[model samples]
Target: MKFTRRASANWKGTGMEGTGTVSTQSTVLNQTQYSFKTRFADGVGTNPEELIGAAHAGCFTMQFSFLLNEAGFTADNIDTEAKVNFEDGSIVSINLDLTATIPNISDEQFQTIAAAAKEKCPISRLFKTEITLTAKLA
Candidate 1:
């Protein structure tokens, strides 16, 4: 791979009571706090699922934009949200919600492009689980 992004985590103590901080090479999440509370409860920090959701959303949106460009369409706006559903200590599914504003595009075309983007996004491909998408054109 030509691109290599990196992140690291540090923890002190047991999983339940332990506190940890995650850092990325870009320092966007420099020593960001994460713990059991953050992952499974109402804690004031980031969680793994949340990060996964963000990555999926970012990747999917970019892929959608590129697909649109290839289809000879330019979107005025493209909004996407990814919800990673964690169950039984595994990621069972993911739901991608998208709203886009593009000119001169039919619903059939939009749906095809949306589905393509969802499937082609690297994060979506990385997960071995059901992925659903809801795309709205405006």
Candidate 2:
């Protein structure tokens, strides 16, 4: 019922000229900076926010797929994009955009299932921030 991951980071110089290494016991991320123009793809390492977004999106989509199946529907593909914004040393908002290609479902039913998935998803339960989800069925 509990899971955890350990990651480490090291920074040199100031925000602009500084670079850092972020590593986990399994993954080593080096030469990454959260300053200037450096970000998820800006360096050789990945940032925490980016990783969080990826985790949230991936988790939500998989949860949605399972929930839909339980609701007598199936998804051909479920893609989610998550955005997390930070401000004043806190996460401001978490936005999720989900596009699903589902079969044998009406819009109302899809919305119902998607709403249940959003509420029941493990990642959705983990964060205590404002989370917005836009679900599109195609």
> Which number leads on lDDT?
1
Return the TM-score for candidate 2, rounded to 2 decimals.
Answer: 0.78
Cα RMSD (Å) between model 1 and the true structure?
0.9
- Residue-level lDDT of model 2, residues 1-138, one tens digit each, is 798977677877887677776666675443344543456246555667887898899899889989888888778888899999888778888999988888778989988888888899998899999999898888
Which segments of candidate 1 are over 4 A away from where they belong?
A: none
The lDDT of each candidate is 0.95, 0.80
TM per candidate: 0.97, 0.78
lDDT of 1: 0.95
lDDT of 1 by residue, 1-138 (tens): 588899999999999999999999999999999999999999899999999999999999999999999999999999999999999999999999999999999999999999999889999999999999999998
Give the clashing pairs for model 1: none
